[model samples]
Target chain A: MRRYYVDYFLIFLGSFLIVYIVLPIAVILVLQIFDFSMLLKALQDERVLKALKNTLITSTATMLISLIFGVPLGYVLARKDFRGKSIIQGIVDVPIVIPHSVVGIMLLITFSSAIVDNYIGIIMAMLFVSASFTINSARDGFLAIDENLEHVARTLGASKLRTFFTISLPLALPSILSGAIMTFARAMSEVGSILIVAYYPKTAQILVMEYFENYGLRASRPIAVLLILISLTIFITMRWIVGRRRYA
Target chain B: MLKLKNVSKDWKEFKIENIELEVKKNEYFVILGPSGAGKTLLLETIAGIHIPDSGRIYMDGIDVTELPPERREIAYIPQNYALFPHMSVYDNIAYGLKIRKAGNIDETVRRLAEVLGIVHLLNRKPKTLSGGEQQRVAIARALAVQPKILLLDEPFSNLDVQIRSKLMEEIKRWRREFEFTAVHVTHNFEEAFCLADRIGIMLNGRIVQVGKPDNVFLKPKNEDIARFLGYENIFEGHADGSRVRIGGITLSSNVTTFGRIKVAIRPEDVIISKSDGEFEAKVESIESFGFASKVTLSINGLKLKALTTTSKIIEEKIREGDRVYVSLRGFNLL
Candidate 1:
């Protein structure tokens, strides 16, 4: 009886945060459904379409770049025990805790005008904020694998590179895929750094802010709904693919 | 043939120090050691998974100390079999052939699977196999490569008792069938006795003794090896010639040692008889281990352990306080 009461109380407490997260998204989706024609109009707008395309391409490019660099770093971090390992891992996680505007400033100082107001600037900003997800996720994925598998592969006449490709990489794929999904989602939702760094490439996020400032919430709300819908769709679809791959 | 010339590796907590060893071609050398004795590290060192801080490893008399595992023509199966969970059984068996770009991949895989009784499991993933099946698959994968040396690290430690013995028998048959040299490591003495062509007793990161299984089992080199070998009756005694004087008894040993010596008697060698024998002792305790009972006796204040069948306890009516005659059938001096 006491256990039942504790369970009920715990769930009631948990529902507060769950509802806090779900309420706004549910309200926005519901409001957009009532003004569904506005969402269609926003979708048809050339400016909106261009911004969406820019956001999609830049976010995907950021994810790919992160995958290219982060996976190797993650594998090394997970497998090796060299000097300054903890320091390197701490550095990998440093970007996550930094303020987004400071991240923009740091990139601005590091790369200067070479990346300013361009697709490279947007990607650099997004990568700065989102690469950690891929690295940490890949590290955790590689860590979860049995090192003995690689050892066995090596002993069975597989070179280190071959073992990595045939055993380690394939075994850690689900985790890497999920990490890629997070990287893409994080890159797509990034607005603060892009606001300071590359506002001209006008991602859907930037367009929403611009439309709101110029024409109030009524105009911006449709694009916001569209962004939410697209992000959710991509996120859910990627998650489903990862889940299926994992079990398969 | 494989040889380790004083190979040593210093791990964080465990280290194998100056591991000097050799395994002849087609020999099944079993390294018997307790856990944390660095047996796996030693095997890894031999397999080229780790480079020794000092000393050299030679394969077929060629220095392979600096060679990578892939170039060494060795196959290692860690405890739990370490099967490739993602690959099918057939693909796993074919992995080495694929790497070598060897011809007849399908024929080799199917032959190994058929021999190991995993032919029906060709397309099944490792996650779906039982422990014994997984072991057979691991062996099939390792043997499919036709490695010069096969290294197994406690391969049967994960299986049930019945399965373990059955696999041990199967492994022995497989060795004859494949004709490969193997260096197997395990903590179980029964496994060592059953599978070892030559047994090396390792203790505290060192190979303390190595010889034929019967010789090593009968004569452990030191107190630690004796203890690890399950000699329950070890005592410090003074010996002159063949007679060793313990608390109040003089036992005749085969070895002639000096004034101070350590004597060990396996519990099974200490015979407890109902009729008169050599020395008289009072039964102090009796502990039953299902099939056999360990009878602890006090012979003139010196405690000794003797093993007897449980049925003998009932037949002889050997109680805790009963008087019994004890005889030392065999003893070794260390």
Candidate 2:
């Protein structure tokens, strides 16, 4: 008797979910393609191309930096017990919950002092907010690995670092890759923080907002539409590469 | 040669207290006990993974207590084998030598893998291999290092019966062929019997007895040791200066105990016959093993275990309701 109610409830919830999440995206997608000239103007702009390049380079750099630092951090969190471990983990996840504007303000306070306003400031802001994704994912990946793998390597005469690089890293690759992708995506969409810390060299998200504010809806719509298309394209390509690796 | 002198380690809930052991060069030393005896802790201590709070670890007379694993030069294969899943079988075997910057590393790895019958599995990763194959690769990887001593903790417990027996035989053969010294720890007496040149019986983190497997089984140091060794014939009896008072009967024995004492006897020592003896017992039931049949008997409601040949059981025609005269030819008093 209860099973029937459960089935009906599940169907209701699933349909509601489909309508809730997919409806707005469907509307925007249809408007961007069907309304024609908006897509044309977005594609032709040199400023849009520059923003695209900036976003791609900064996000990619953010992801690379995250992987290099995050894998070890994840492994330590997953495998070891040390003082302040839980506190350190909580610290790693702090940026994700904070407001984007707040993150931007915090970066400005720290980086506006002349040492970090260059590439360092941009990269650090992106990493601060996005690296948590990689760290958390890598932690899960490392946790899934059987500890016996590292133990065996140690017994076989491989040093701790060698065992980590040769065994732990490969087995945890899927998770690390997922984390990197998440960080990349998060960094690419960053606008509020980049605006405060490094606004002169505009990212695509900032460009879209700038066009919308300066020149009314007509001039701004094309850039907004362009930003969305380019972001989606890069996101889809990353997913495809990771998906292939999974099968392999 | 491996030696652990006054070794003590505490692993949260379990503590191995003052464990002292020595495995001679080329000796197959097996540590046997029930659960929570800290057998695995002893193995790990020798492996240098767990440092003892108070002990001196010596390999071939050199003190290596404070040495890191690489400097200690001990190879340890845990129960799970800990195979590196990312590396191919060939790379896994080659890892140690590659790091140590040794010449002819390929030759060494290839030779060990071939000996372990894992040469054909060289290119495959550990996850692609079966349990038995992975176990062999783990062993091969350890053997490739050619450490002074090898520690194996429950290496056979993971395999199925069919594979376990075959692997046991292969492991024995490999040990003899390579002349490698090993310290194996397990709860199974059969593993201790078949593989060990010498056995150490551990109880509550202490090495209670260390000797040939037969000697330890035949002569347990105490009643608890006897029971731990699967000798389930322990009874509290009184030695009243003349003879000991057991279940409803007093046996004539020269062995003397001061007051209330525990009498331990191996089931194999008790003999059941239809002749006049000092005592009498009724046959409860008989269960058959491959070579031996265990006859359960009742002496004034006190249960006793006796092992006899299957032919003796048949010739005596022992049944649940049958009456038989029981006698003790001899016993090992602990």
Candidate 3:
């Protein structure tokens, strides 16, 4: 019976990590409620609106481009085996391992002067740092599906491409959607890459950084709190949708 | 007709070598082998799931060796049924039709679903259905396409014995109605006996023998096959014209041969007696097997087994360490 208390104490100690993160976000949210006018003013600011719009547009573009390229790569990684497959898989994970600032520098070197000041540059930088989530998640989703399902479709007079679209794609859609959401979130939160590549089409993260640098914590706190609030809301909603249909 | 000439494939641990097989139109061919005998690999190769390293596959006199699965018009029901978990039974059955944009999709799916007795399960996903229900759905999905050949990879293996036999009967009925050729693979001899027009026994990675069910079961072509088919006593012996000699015992054979050869006798064919027989042996062990008891007998440095009824065992007062007379009812020389 005394051992039970020890076990409970251990659990309580482990739960402090959750509290550590929740306490700061909770403090920020509660403080912003008292200074609600600052949040309203941040929302009304044309520069803030433009920055948020840019973030949304670029993240969505990154997600669509990730889907176009990542899904096929995911399927290949999941289904096929050839020489150097391990090397290919390792390369897919390189973005997650490397620093985001390095990714921005690498993209700049590869794309040269054309990529340094364009909206495409922002998307490319964000995609370089974030697309790993989509690719790995989609690969896992494809791996979860049985190879027999695809074979059965093939034996039933459906071509390979047809089987992929009709069976594998639909079955793995939930995981892919969840991955896209994460990729979008990661792209939205990206700051280092965007800061170097394209400063004109500033994302919300960069905007928050600019405000903090120009006018201390008071000016920047409202935008930071609003960004956190919106990100949390969208993240929770997407997760709920994923949980409801999590076949993959 | 479907034919495979020298079909071969090599995986890391399993390989099929020089496989030659033929199935006539509307024939039910069963490939019988023990576990790890490359049975599933051969089935997959026929289904085009695995491209053969070297072979030619023919269907209706057309060379389909280079054709992909879709172009070959074959339907494969894998061991686990492999029903799409995300799709409802209706959609699963309709998937092939939808892909091809075939005519009368709903009517065809409805008719096949009704035939397979899964009409009630059309709205349910595969995970929601019972094993038998899922099996029925898989069969419906495969049959909906009306392919040239249907490949069944141990379709009844995951079911209880009762369900297995029931599905076996259902498969026959469906085949008769649909008139489709099939290549069914299983390790169970009972399955081969129940559903096969012709059976092939596979060992290691080769089809050691192919014949009618009774022929293959009763007379395996070689010592390896005989051993695989549960022939208890197999001995290398000398065949001299009409008689074969094993150790000190000489037995008459209908096969006229000369020189060294292998002889096989099934356990059930060894007749055991208490009083009068040519050979005398001591009882080694007796094991009770429900309706029958398996008796092991040692004679002249040879071990042989016999299956006798439980009543006969009690009547004869047979037990371990008892002396018993034994005689060979028949034996095959290979």
- Number of the top candidate by TM-score? 1
- Each candidate structure's count of clashing pairs: 0, 0, 0
After superposition, the stretches of candidate 2 with alpha carbons farther than 4 Å from their true spots are A1-5, A113-120, A215-222, A236-248, B240-243, B252-260, B268-278, B283-296, B307-322
Model 2 clashing residue pairs (backbone): none
Q: Write the per-residue lDDT of candidate 3 for residues A1-248, one digit (tens) a residue.
A: 99999999999999999999899999988998999998899989999888888888998999999989999999899999899999999998898888888888888888888988778999999899888888988999999999999998888888888888889998888889899889989998998877888887778888899999998887898889978987898899999899888843
Give the best candidate by DockQ. 1
Error of 2 at B272 (Å): 4.5
The digit string of per-residue lDDT tens for model 1 on A1-248 reads 89999999999999999999999999999998998888889988999999999999999999999999999999999999999999999999998899999988888889889888999999999999999999999999999999999999999999999999999999899999899999999999998889888998789999999999999998999999888989999999999999999999
DockQ of each: 0.92, 0.60, 0.79
Candidate 1 lDDT by residue in tens digits, B74-97? 999999789998999888999999
Q: What is the lDDT of residue B11 in candidate 1?
A: 80
Query: In order, what lDDT does every prediction score?
Result: 0.93, 0.83, 0.89
RMSD of 1: 1.3
The residue-by-residue lDDT of candidate 2 on A30-108, one tens digit each, is 7777778866777777888887787788888999999989988999999999999999999998997998889878877
Score chain A of each prediction against the true chain A by TM-score and list the results.
Answer: 0.98, 0.90, 0.96
Query: What's candidate 3's DockQ score?
Result: 0.79
Question: Candidate 2 chain B: worst 10 consecutive residues by lDDT?
Answer: B250-259
Docking class of 2: medium
